[model samples]
Target: MKKVITLTLPGELIFTRLAAQTAASVAALVCGECHPKDNNCEFINAFELAVSEAFTNSALHACQDELPPVTLTFIAERHQLTVTVRDTNEPFGIETPQPDIESYPEGGYGLLIIRKVMDTVTYRRDGDANIISMSKKL
Candidate 1:
């Protein structure tokens, strides 16, 4: 069976924790359905981290003045989970240069971490909305 979950949140840093928790909860449900026995699955952690990073990036970089609305959609299948985050703010391209880990920069590692953890990551502009889609195999 396939399950779909959707969440709409304010595009503000204050709601980042809420976004993370929501993603984690859905990920846990999906992981449990996919892997019945293993409670401490790594996929849950990866999903939480990737979703949180995406949410934070949208909240910080996408909005200008009043925060917009961020939409998160999760599609859970038998063996894979796909997440899409959409924001109405200006579409800032996601082509960020790989940050040098050796330097340990204080910021700019969100995209890097997201790409590293998620099996597939993509960004596109749909009219006025910026959509980031990430997928991971469970």
Candidate 2:
């Protein structure tokens, strides 16, 4: 069976923090729903981190100046967790940072972290919206 939760977040600081809080909540639910015996410490932490980074990126980059609302959707199934964050803003092209800069960089590292944590990071452009889909196996 699959469980889904969708949340609409305002393009504001308070709502931004709420997004991270929401990610943690979902992680807890998934950990309990999937494997109560094992809390999935590592995977749970990674999911929380990646979700926070991705949401922050969308609220900051994609919705820049426009203050467009961001939609965060969490889907948990038998053995996988899929987080879909969509924003009705221009898609900002992102490229992996250079190997040298990737190490000691203070910025432009969110996508790198997302790639490392999530099993798959997919991007789709729908008209003027950018949809970022991140998945991790439970």
Q: Whose lDDT is greatest here?
A: 1
Q: After superposing candidate 1 on the true structure, give the runs of residues whose Cα lies further than 4 Å from its correct spot.
A: 33-40, 62-64
| Cα lDDT tens digits for candidate 2, 7-29 | 98865555766787677677767
Candidate 1 lDDT over 1-138, as tens digits, reads 888888999899888888877777777787775442344667877877888999998898754777888999999999988999999887777789998889988888888899998999999999999999999997
lDDT assessment of candidate 2: 0.77
Please identify model 2 stretches exceeding 4 Å from their true place: 33-40, 62-66, 98-103
Residue 114 C-alpha lDDT in model 1: 93
